[model samples]
Target: MHAATTVSLIPVLSDNYVFVLHGGGSGAAVVDPAVAEPVIAWLEERGLELEAILHTHHHNDHIGGTPGLLQRWPQAAVIASAADRERIPLQTQGVQGGDRLTLLGRHLRVVEVPGHTRHHIAYVLEPQAEEAAELFCGDTLFAGGCGRLFEGTPEQMLSSLQSLSALGTSTRVWCAHEYTEGNLRWAAEREPGNSAIAERLAAVQQQRREGQPTIPSSIGVELATNLFVRAQDAAALRQLRGHKDLWRG
Candidate 1:
Protein backbone atom coordinates (compact mmCIF):
# COMPACT_ATOMS: atom_id res chain seq x y z
CA MET A 1 0.00 0.00 0.00
CA HIS A 2 1.17 3.51 -0.79
CA ALA A 3 1.90 5.80 2.11
CA ALA A 4 -0.72 8.51 2.45
CA THR A 5 0.34 12.06 1.72
CA THR A 6 0.49 14.35 4.76
CA VAL A 7 -0.25 18.09 5.03
CA SER A 8 0.80 20.35 7.92
CA LEU A 9 0.94 24.06 8.74
CA ILE A 10 3.32 26.71 10.07
CA PRO A 11 1.69 29.82 11.52
CA VAL A 12 3.36 33.11 10.69
CA LEU A 13 2.78 36.88 10.39
CA SER A 14 -0.02 37.16 12.98
CA ASP A 15 -2.68 34.85 11.50
CA ASN A 16 -1.31 33.59 8.20
CA TYR A 17 -0.59 29.87 7.82
CA VAL A 18 1.90 28.26 5.48
CA PHE A 19 1.14 24.65 4.54
CA VAL A 20 3.65 21.91 3.84
CA LEU A 21 2.88 18.71 1.93
CA HIS A 22 4.91 15.53 1.93
CA GLY A 23 4.46 11.86 1.22
CA GLY A 24 6.82 10.31 3.75
CA GLY A 25 9.90 11.43 1.86
CA SER A 26 12.81 13.81 2.24
CA GLY A 27 11.12 16.22 -0.20
CA ALA A 28 8.16 18.53 0.53
CA ALA A 29 6.14 21.28 -1.13
CA VAL A 30 5.00 24.49 0.57
CA VAL A 31 1.85 26.51 -0.14
CA ASP A 32 1.42 30.30 0.17
CA PRO A 33 4.37 30.93 2.41
CA ALA A 34 3.78 34.29 4.13
CA VAL A 35 7.43 34.37 5.24
CA ALA A 36 10.47 32.17 4.74
CA GLU A 37 12.44 31.95 7.96
CA PRO A 38 9.91 29.80 9.84
CA VAL A 39 9.12 27.61 6.85
CA ILE A 40 12.80 27.05 6.08
CA ALA A 41 13.45 26.25 9.73
CA TRP A 42 10.48 23.86 9.87
CA LEU A 43 11.63 21.93 6.79
CA GLU A 44 15.28 21.89 7.77
CA GLU A 45 14.37 20.62 11.25
CA ARG A 46 12.52 17.72 9.65
CA GLY A 47 15.41 17.07 7.26
CA LEU A 48 13.16 17.71 4.25
CA GLU A 49 14.21 19.44 1.05
CA LEU A 50 11.93 21.95 -0.65
CA GLU A 51 10.67 20.61 -3.97
CA ALA A 52 8.11 23.26 -4.94
CA ILE A 53 6.43 26.48 -3.75
CA LEU A 54 2.74 26.99 -4.61
CA HIS A 55 1.20 30.44 -4.63
CA THR A 56 -2.56 31.01 -4.63
CA HIS A 57 -2.48 34.74 -5.17
CA HIS A 58 -0.06 37.68 -5.46
CA HIS A 59 -0.74 39.42 -2.15
CA ASN A 60 2.43 40.56 -0.42
CA ASP A 61 1.79 38.29 2.56
CA HIS A 62 1.17 35.31 0.29
CA ILE A 63 4.10 35.67 -2.09
CA GLY A 64 6.56 37.67 -0.01
CA GLY A 65 8.39 34.58 1.17
CA THR A 66 8.97 33.10 -2.30
CA PRO A 67 12.27 34.87 -2.94
CA GLY A 68 13.69 33.84 0.41
CA LEU A 69 12.57 30.23 -0.05
CA LEU A 70 14.08 30.12 -3.55
CA GLN A 71 17.33 31.35 -2.08
CA ARG A 72 17.39 28.23 0.09
CA TRP A 73 16.15 25.80 -2.58
CA PRO A 74 17.22 27.47 -5.80
CA GLN A 75 16.01 24.56 -7.92
CA ALA A 76 12.57 24.29 -6.31
CA ALA A 77 9.74 24.95 -8.73
CA VAL A 78 7.56 28.01 -8.05
CA ILE A 79 4.05 27.32 -9.41
CA ALA A 80 1.50 30.11 -9.82
CA SER A 81 -1.21 31.44 -12.14
CA ALA A 82 -0.09 32.23 -15.67
CA ALA A 83 -2.58 35.10 -15.94
CA ASP A 84 -1.05 36.88 -12.94
CA ARG A 85 2.57 36.73 -14.07
CA GLU A 86 2.86 40.51 -13.89
CA ARG A 87 2.11 40.42 -10.17
CA ILE A 88 3.70 37.09 -9.24
CA PRO A 89 6.70 37.46 -11.52
CA LEU A 90 8.89 34.87 -9.87
CA GLN A 91 6.71 31.88 -10.75
CA THR A 92 8.60 29.13 -12.58
CA GLN A 93 5.56 27.10 -13.71
CA GLY A 94 2.62 29.22 -14.86
CA VAL A 95 -0.65 27.29 -14.85
CA GLN A 96 -4.36 27.94 -15.44
CA GLY A 97 -7.72 26.38 -14.62
CA GLY A 98 -8.01 22.62 -15.24
CA ASP A 99 -4.25 22.25 -15.52
CA ARG A 100 -2.80 19.24 -13.71
CA LEU A 101 0.66 18.75 -12.27
CA THR A 102 2.48 16.29 -10.06
CA LEU A 103 4.20 17.29 -6.83
CA LEU A 104 5.47 14.92 -4.17
CA GLY A 105 4.10 12.14 -6.44
CA ARG A 106 0.51 13.35 -5.98
CA HIS A 107 -1.68 14.91 -8.67
CA LEU A 108 -2.93 18.48 -8.13
CA ARG A 109 -5.54 20.32 -10.19
CA VAL A 110 -5.35 24.09 -10.59
CA VAL A 111 -8.65 25.87 -10.03
CA GLU A 112 -9.14 29.47 -11.15
CA VAL A 113 -10.94 31.09 -8.22
CA PRO A 114 -10.69 34.80 -8.86
CA GLY A 115 -12.39 36.94 -6.25
CA HIS A 116 -9.77 37.96 -3.75
CA THR A 117 -7.65 38.80 -6.76
CA ARG A 118 -8.26 38.84 -10.49
CA HIS A 119 -5.93 35.94 -11.11
CA HIS A 120 -6.20 34.03 -7.86
CA ILE A 121 -6.07 30.24 -8.22
CA ALA A 122 -6.42 27.27 -5.87
CA TYR A 123 -4.68 23.92 -5.84
CA VAL A 124 -6.76 20.79 -5.32
CA LEU A 125 -4.59 17.87 -4.35
CA GLU A 126 -6.49 14.78 -5.46
CA PRO A 127 -7.23 12.02 -2.98
CA GLN A 128 -4.75 9.19 -2.91
CA ALA A 129 -5.35 5.59 -1.81
CA GLU A 130 -6.42 6.27 1.79
CA GLU A 131 -5.87 10.00 2.06
CA ALA A 132 -8.62 12.57 1.68
CA ALA A 133 -8.45 15.39 -0.90
CA GLU A 134 -6.95 18.70 0.21
CA LEU A 135 -7.73 22.26 -0.92
CA PHE A 136 -5.13 24.99 -0.43
CA CYS A 137 -7.55 27.84 -1.12
CA GLY A 138 -5.40 30.79 -0.04
CA ASP A 139 -7.63 33.69 1.02
CA THR A 140 -10.59 32.80 -1.16
CA LEU A 141 -12.49 30.61 1.30
CA PHE A 142 -12.13 30.81 5.06
CA ALA A 143 -13.64 28.63 7.76
CA GLY A 144 -16.94 30.54 8.10
CA GLY A 145 -16.50 33.43 5.71
CA CYS A 146 -15.16 34.04 2.19
CA GLY A 147 -12.49 36.46 1.12
CA ARG A 148 -13.32 40.14 0.70
CA LEU A 149 -13.91 40.86 -2.99
CA PHE A 150 -10.93 43.02 -3.72
CA GLU A 151 -10.35 42.73 -7.48
CA GLY A 152 -13.31 40.75 -8.78
CA THR A 153 -17.08 41.34 -8.95
CA PRO A 154 -19.71 39.76 -6.73
CA GLU A 155 -20.80 37.50 -9.58
CA GLN A 156 -17.24 36.29 -10.06
CA MET A 157 -16.86 35.57 -6.36
CA LEU A 158 -20.14 33.70 -6.26
CA SER A 159 -19.09 31.58 -9.20
CA SER A 160 -15.66 30.99 -7.71
CA LEU A 161 -17.17 29.85 -4.41
CA GLN A 162 -19.67 27.58 -6.14
CA SER A 163 -16.86 25.83 -7.98
CA LEU A 164 -15.02 25.25 -4.73
CA SER A 165 -18.20 24.01 -3.07
CA ALA A 166 -18.41 21.23 -5.63
CA LEU A 167 -15.00 19.86 -4.70
CA GLY A 168 -16.76 17.33 -2.43
CA THR A 169 -17.97 17.69 1.14
CA SER A 170 -15.14 15.65 2.55
CA THR A 171 -12.36 17.73 1.07
CA ARG A 172 -10.20 19.30 3.78
CA VAL A 173 -10.15 23.07 3.29
CA TRP A 174 -6.78 24.46 4.34
CA CYS A 175 -7.33 28.18 3.99
CA ALA A 176 -4.53 30.74 4.61
CA HIS A 177 -5.49 32.35 7.92
CA GLU A 178 -6.56 31.67 11.49
CA TYR A 179 -9.82 33.64 11.27
CA THR A 180 -12.34 30.97 12.12
CA GLU A 181 -13.49 32.39 15.47
CA GLY A 182 -14.12 35.87 14.16
CA ASN A 183 -15.69 34.55 10.98
CA LEU A 184 -18.00 32.29 12.91
CA ARG A 185 -18.90 35.02 15.40
CA TRP A 186 -19.94 37.17 12.48
CA ALA A 187 -21.77 34.25 10.97
CA ALA A 188 -23.76 33.61 14.14
CA GLU A 189 -24.94 37.22 14.13
CA ARG A 190 -25.99 36.86 10.50
CA GLU A 191 -27.83 33.67 11.29
CA PRO A 192 -29.11 33.90 14.85
CA GLY A 193 -31.44 30.94 14.69
CA ASN A 194 -29.14 28.51 12.94
CA SER A 195 -28.29 25.64 15.26
CA ALA A 196 -25.37 24.53 13.10
CA ILE A 197 -23.87 27.99 13.33
CA ALA A 198 -24.53 28.14 17.05
CA GLU A 199 -23.07 24.70 17.68
CA ARG A 200 -19.98 25.38 15.59
CA LEU A 201 -19.52 28.73 17.28
CA ALA A 202 -19.69 27.13 20.73
CA ALA A 203 -17.24 24.41 19.75
CA VAL A 204 -14.89 26.89 18.11
CA GLN A 205 -15.10 29.16 21.13
CA GLN A 206 -13.99 26.31 23.36
CA GLN A 207 -11.17 25.46 20.99
CA ARG A 208 -10.00 29.06 20.98
CA ARG A 209 -10.18 29.28 24.76
CA GLU A 210 -7.80 26.35 24.83
CA GLY A 211 -5.38 28.22 22.55
CA GLN A 212 -5.89 25.90 19.61
CA PRO A 213 -5.90 26.67 15.92
CA THR A 214 -9.34 26.67 14.30
CA ILE A 215 -8.59 25.62 10.76
CA PRO A 216 -8.73 22.77 8.30
CA SER A 217 -12.51 23.18 8.32
CA SER A 218 -14.20 20.74 5.96
CA ILE A 219 -16.47 21.76 3.07
CA GLY A 220 -19.33 20.01 4.85
CA VAL A 221 -18.95 22.28 7.90
CA GLU A 222 -18.76 25.37 5.71
CA LEU A 223 -21.82 24.33 3.74
CA ALA A 224 -23.72 24.11 7.00
CA THR A 225 -22.46 27.19 8.84
CA ASN A 226 -20.72 29.55 6.44
CA LEU A 227 -23.20 32.29 5.56
CA PHE A 228 -21.07 33.30 2.58
CA VAL A 229 -21.12 29.80 1.16
CA ARG A 230 -24.85 29.56 1.83
CA ALA A 231 -25.61 32.80 -0.01
CA GLN A 232 -28.10 31.95 -2.72
CA ASP A 233 -27.31 34.60 -5.34
CA ALA A 234 -24.98 37.41 -6.31
CA ALA A 235 -27.17 40.06 -4.69
CA ALA A 236 -27.12 38.14 -1.41
CA LEU A 237 -23.39 37.72 -1.64
CA ARG A 238 -22.93 41.41 -2.38
CA GLN A 239 -24.94 42.39 0.66
CA LEU A 240 -23.04 39.99 2.89
CA ARG A 241 -19.67 41.11 1.61
CA GLY A 242 -20.61 44.74 2.16
CA HIS A 243 -21.70 44.02 5.72
CA LYS A 244 -18.55 42.03 6.43
CA ASP A 245 -16.39 44.89 5.17
CA LEU A 246 -17.80 47.33 7.69
CA TRP A 247 -17.84 44.81 10.50
CA ARG A 248 -15.32 45.52 13.27
CA GLY A 249 -15.44 41.98 14.62
Candidate 2:
Protein backbone atom coordinates (compact mmCIF):
# COMPACT_ATOMS: atom_id res chain seq x y z
CA MET A 1 0.00 0.00 0.00
CA HIS A 2 1.15 3.52 -0.79
CA ALA A 3 2.11 5.69 2.13
CA ALA A 4 -0.50 8.23 3.12
CA THR A 5 0.17 11.90 2.62
CA THR A 6 0.25 14.19 5.64
CA VAL A 7 -1.40 17.61 5.65
CA SER A 8 -0.84 20.38 8.19
CA LEU A 9 -2.84 23.56 8.49
CA ILE A 10 -1.19 26.90 9.23
CA PRO A 11 -3.53 29.75 10.00
CA VAL A 12 -2.58 33.14 8.64
CA LEU A 13 -4.01 36.65 8.49
CA SER A 14 -7.38 36.76 10.24
CA ASP A 15 -8.94 33.58 8.90
CA ASN A 16 -7.01 32.15 5.95
CA TYR A 17 -5.29 28.77 6.22
CA VAL A 18 -2.20 27.62 4.38
CA PHE A 19 -2.05 23.85 3.92
CA VAL A 20 1.27 22.06 3.95
CA LEU A 21 1.37 18.65 2.28
CA HIS A 22 4.19 16.26 2.99
CA GLY A 23 4.61 12.53 2.62
CA GLY A 24 7.24 11.58 5.19
CA GLY A 25 9.83 13.18 2.92
CA SER A 26 12.29 16.01 3.32
CA GLY A 27 10.54 17.92 0.54
CA ALA A 28 7.16 19.52 1.21
CA ALA A 29 4.63 21.59 -0.76
CA VAL A 30 2.28 24.31 0.47
CA VAL A 31 -1.15 25.20 -0.83
CA ASP A 32 -1.96 28.96 -0.85
CA PRO A 33 0.35 30.57 1.61
CA ALA A 34 -1.48 33.77 2.56
CA VAL A 35 1.73 34.95 4.16
CA ALA A 36 5.27 33.63 4.14
CA GLU A 37 6.65 33.97 7.67
CA PRO A 38 4.38 31.38 9.33
CA VAL A 39 4.68 28.87 6.52
CA ILE A 40 8.43 29.28 6.15
CA ALA A 41 8.93 28.93 9.89
CA TRP A 42 6.68 25.87 10.04
CA LEU A 43 8.64 24.12 7.29
CA GLU A 44 12.04 25.11 8.67
CA GLU A 45 11.17 24.06 12.21
CA ARG A 46 10.47 20.58 10.93
CA GLY A 47 13.72 20.58 8.89
CA LEU A 48 11.68 20.22 5.71
CA GLU A 49 12.59 21.96 2.46
CA LEU A 50 9.97 23.77 0.43
CA GLU A 51 9.52 22.04 -2.90
CA ALA A 52 6.47 23.64 -4.52
CA ILE A 53 3.81 26.27 -3.96
CA LEU A 54 0.29 25.49 -5.22
CA HIS A 55 -1.93 28.45 -6.00
CA THR A 56 -5.67 28.22 -6.41
CA HIS A 57 -6.13 31.77 -7.67
CA HIS A 58 -4.38 35.08 -8.22
CA HIS A 59 -5.86 36.77 -5.19
CA ASN A 60 -3.31 38.50 -3.00
CA ASP A 61 -4.19 36.45 0.03
CA HIS A 62 -3.76 33.29 -2.02
CA ILE A 63 -0.55 34.10 -3.89
CA GLY A 64 0.83 36.90 -1.73
CA GLY A 65 3.47 34.80 0.00
CA THR A 66 4.81 33.06 -3.13
CA PRO A 67 7.59 35.57 -3.66
CA GLY A 68 8.70 35.39 -0.04
CA LEU A 69 8.58 31.59 -0.02
CA LEU A 70 10.42 31.46 -3.34
CA GLN A 71 13.07 33.79 -1.88
CA ARG A 72 13.78 31.23 0.84
CA TRP A 73 13.62 28.29 -1.57
CA PRO A 74 14.48 29.91 -4.84
CA GLN A 75 14.02 26.71 -6.82
CA ALA A 76 10.56 25.86 -5.47
CA ALA A 77 7.98 25.31 -8.22
CA VAL A 78 5.07 27.72 -8.46
CA ILE A 79 2.03 25.82 -9.70
CA ALA A 80 -0.88 27.94 -10.85
CA SER A 81 -3.41 28.35 -13.67
CA ALA A 82 -1.99 28.77 -17.16
CA ALA A 83 -4.88 31.05 -18.04
CA ASP A 84 -3.87 33.34 -15.18
CA ARG A 85 -0.20 33.54 -16.07
CA GLU A 86 -0.41 37.26 -16.72
CA ARG A 87 -1.84 37.89 -13.28
CA ILE A 88 0.23 35.31 -11.39
CA PRO A 89 3.56 35.87 -13.08
CA LEU A 90 5.44 33.67 -10.63
CA GLN A 91 3.86 30.50 -12.02
CA THR A 92 6.49 28.01 -13.17
CA GLN A 93 4.12 25.12 -13.85
CA GLY A 94 1.01 26.68 -15.37
CA VAL A 95 -1.69 24.02 -15.51
CA GLN A 96 -5.42 23.71 -16.12
CA GLY A 97 -8.27 21.30 -15.48
CA GLY A 98 -7.70 17.60 -16.22
CA ASP A 99 -3.98 17.97 -15.60
CA ARG A 100 -2.19 15.72 -13.12
CA LEU A 101 1.08 16.15 -11.28
CA THR A 102 3.10 14.24 -8.73
CA LEU A 103 4.31 15.76 -5.48
CA LEU A 104 6.09 14.05 -2.63
CA GLY A 105 5.31 10.64 -4.18
CA ARG A 106 1.59 11.46 -4.22
CA HIS A 107 -0.56 12.22 -7.28
CA LEU A 108 -2.74 15.31 -7.50
CA ARG A 109 -5.41 16.11 -10.08
CA VAL A 110 -6.08 19.71 -11.04
CA VAL A 111 -9.71 20.64 -11.10
CA GLU A 112 -10.70 24.00 -12.62
CA VAL A 113 -13.41 25.53 -10.49
CA PRO A 114 -13.89 29.13 -11.49
CA GLY A 115 -16.48 31.28 -9.73
CA HIS A 116 -14.90 33.66 -7.22
CA THR A 117 -12.21 34.24 -9.80
CA ARG A 118 -12.04 33.58 -13.52
CA HIS A 119 -9.22 31.06 -13.36
CA HIS A 120 -9.57 29.55 -9.91
CA ILE A 121 -8.69 25.88 -9.58
CA ALA A 122 -8.54 23.20 -6.92
CA TYR A 123 -6.19 20.28 -6.23
CA VAL A 124 -7.51 16.84 -5.37
CA LEU A 125 -5.22 14.24 -3.86
CA GLU A 126 -6.92 10.87 -4.13
CA PRO A 127 -6.96 8.49 -1.19
CA GLN A 128 -4.17 5.96 -0.79
CA ALA A 129 -4.87 2.86 1.31
CA GLU A 130 -6.41 4.03 4.57
CA GLU A 131 -6.07 7.73 3.86
CA ALA A 132 -9.02 9.79 2.66
CA ALA A 133 -8.67 12.02 -0.38
CA GLU A 134 -7.97 15.69 0.36
CA LEU A 135 -9.29 18.64 -1.62
CA PHE A 136 -7.42 21.95 -1.41
CA CYS A 137 -10.14 24.28 -2.48
CA GLY A 138 -9.33 27.95 -2.15
CA ASP A 139 -11.98 30.61 -1.94
CA THR A 140 -14.25 28.81 -4.38
CA LEU A 141 -15.98 26.52 -1.92
CA PHE A 142 -16.03 27.37 1.78
CA ALA A 143 -17.13 25.10 4.60
CA GLY A 144 -20.78 26.16 4.69
CA GLY A 145 -20.67 28.85 2.04
CA CYS A 146 -19.33 29.60 -1.43
CA GLY A 147 -17.29 32.55 -2.49
CA ARG A 148 -19.08 35.66 -3.67
CA LEU A 149 -19.25 36.23 -7.43
CA PHE A 150 -16.38 38.55 -8.16
CA GLU A 151 -15.74 37.71 -11.78
CA GLY A 152 -18.08 34.83 -12.63
CA THR A 153 -21.83 34.46 -12.77
CA PRO A 154 -24.04 32.56 -10.36
CA GLU A 155 -24.46 29.82 -12.96
CA GLN A 156 -20.71 29.33 -13.15
CA MET A 157 -20.43 29.29 -9.35
CA LEU A 158 -23.19 26.72 -9.09
CA SER A 159 -21.53 24.52 -11.67
CA SER A 160 -18.20 24.79 -9.91
CA LEU A 161 -19.71 23.95 -6.54
CA GLN A 162 -21.68 21.06 -8.00
CA SER A 163 -18.53 19.58 -9.46
CA LEU A 164 -16.82 19.74 -6.07
CA SER A 165 -19.88 18.32 -4.32
CA ALA A 166 -19.66 15.26 -6.55
CA LEU A 167 -16.41 14.13 -4.97
CA GLY A 168 -16.32 11.22 -2.55
CA THR A 169 -18.32 11.71 0.63
CA SER A 170 -15.23 11.17 2.75
CA THR A 171 -13.06 13.61 0.81
CA ARG A 172 -11.52 16.10 3.23
CA VAL A 173 -12.24 19.67 2.18
CA TRP A 174 -9.53 22.15 3.11
CA CYS A 175 -11.07 25.52 2.49
CA ALA A 176 -8.98 28.68 2.66
CA HIS A 177 -11.01 30.57 5.24
CA GLU A 178 -12.40 30.04 8.76
CA TYR A 179 -15.89 31.11 7.90
CA THR A 180 -17.76 28.03 9.02
CA GLU A 181 -19.44 29.52 12.08
CA GLY A 182 -20.66 32.61 10.27
CA ASN A 183 -21.66 30.63 7.20
CA LEU A 184 -23.62 28.07 9.20
CA ARG A 185 -25.31 30.82 11.17
CA TRP A 186 -26.40 32.46 7.95
CA ALA A 187 -27.49 29.14 6.52
CA ALA A 188 -29.58 28.46 9.59
CA GLU A 189 -31.28 31.82 9.22
CA ARG A 190 -31.75 31.41 5.49
CA GLU A 191 -33.47 28.09 5.99
CA PRO A 192 -34.89 28.42 9.47
CA GLY A 193 -36.46 24.99 9.30
CA ASN A 194 -33.31 23.17 8.18
CA SER A 195 -32.25 20.94 11.03
CA ALA A 196 -28.91 20.20 9.42
CA ILE A 197 -28.03 23.87 9.13
CA ALA A 198 -29.11 24.64 12.70
CA GLU A 199 -27.29 21.67 14.14
CA ARG A 200 -24.11 22.43 12.22
CA LEU A 201 -24.27 26.07 13.26
CA ALA A 202 -24.37 25.11 16.92
CA ALA A 203 -21.43 22.75 16.54
CA VAL A 204 -19.36 25.23 14.55
CA GLN A 205 -20.06 27.97 17.09
CA GLN A 206 -18.86 25.68 19.85
CA GLN A 207 -15.71 24.86 17.93
CA ARG A 208 -14.99 28.54 17.47
CA ARG A 209 -15.78 29.35 21.08
CA GLU A 210 -13.25 26.75 22.13
CA GLY A 211 -10.67 28.34 19.81
CA GLN A 212 -10.47 25.24 17.65
CA PRO A 213 -10.11 25.18 13.88
CA THR A 214 -13.35 24.26 12.19
CA ILE A 215 -11.82 23.23 8.92
CA PRO A 216 -11.05 20.20 6.83
CA SER A 217 -14.81 19.75 6.63
CA SER A 218 -15.82 16.60 4.83
CA ILE A 219 -17.83 16.43 1.59
CA GLY A 220 -20.58 14.54 3.41
CA VAL A 221 -20.87 17.24 6.09
CA GLU A 222 -20.90 20.03 3.54
CA LEU A 223 -23.54 18.30 1.41
CA ALA A 224 -25.64 17.93 4.51
CA THR A 225 -25.25 21.47 5.86
CA ASN A 226 -24.05 23.89 3.18
CA LEU A 227 -27.01 25.76 1.75
CA PHE A 228 -25.10 26.80 -1.32
CA VAL A 229 -24.23 23.21 -2.08
CA ARG A 230 -27.86 22.26 -1.59
CA ALA A 231 -28.98 25.02 -3.95
CA GLN A 232 -31.05 23.43 -6.71
CA ASP A 233 -30.06 25.64 -9.63
CA ALA A 234 -28.46 28.88 -10.78
CA ALA A 235 -31.46 30.98 -9.80
CA ALA A 236 -31.51 29.56 -6.31
CA LEU A 237 -27.77 29.94 -5.95
CA ARG A 238 -27.90 33.53 -7.15
CA GLN A 239 -30.43 34.40 -4.50
CA LEU A 240 -28.41 32.72 -1.79
CA ARG A 241 -25.19 34.44 -2.83
CA GLY A 242 -26.91 37.81 -2.90
CA HIS A 243 -28.33 37.35 0.54
CA LYS A 244 -25.02 36.15 1.89
CA ASP A 245 -23.15 39.17 0.58
CA LEU A 246 -25.44 41.58 2.46
CA TRP A 247 -25.63 39.40 5.54
CA ARG A 248 -23.89 40.95 8.53
CA GLY A 249 -24.74 38.32 11.12
Instruction: Please report, as a residue range, the 10-residue window in candidate 1 with the lowest summed lDDT.
Output: 1-10
Runs in model 1 deviating more than 4 A are none
Candidate 1 lDDT over 33-66, as tens digits, reads 9899999999999999999999999999999999
Cα-based lDDT at residue 139, candidate 2:
96
Instruction: Please estimate how well model 1 matches the true structure, expressed as its whole-model Cα lDDT.
Output: 0.93
Computed on alpha carbons, the lDDT of every model, listed in order, comes to 0.93, 0.93
Q: Give per-candidate clash totals.
A: 0, 0
lDDT of 2 by residue, 1-249 (tens): 445679999999999999999877689999999899999999999999999999999999999999999999999999999999999999999999999999988899999998999999999997787788899999999999999899999999999998899997899999999999889888888889988888888888888989999999999998999889989999999999999999999
Kindly provide the TM-score of model 2 when superposed on the true structure, using C-alpha atoms: 0.98
lDDT of 2 at 78: 96
Over the full model, what C-alpha lDDT does candidate 2 score relative to the true structure? 0.93
Q: What is the TM-score of each predicted model, taking all chains together?
A: 0.98, 0.98
Taking every candidate in turn, the Cα RMSD to the unseen true structure, in Å, is 0.8, 0.8
Looking at model 2, residue 115 earns an lDDT score of 90
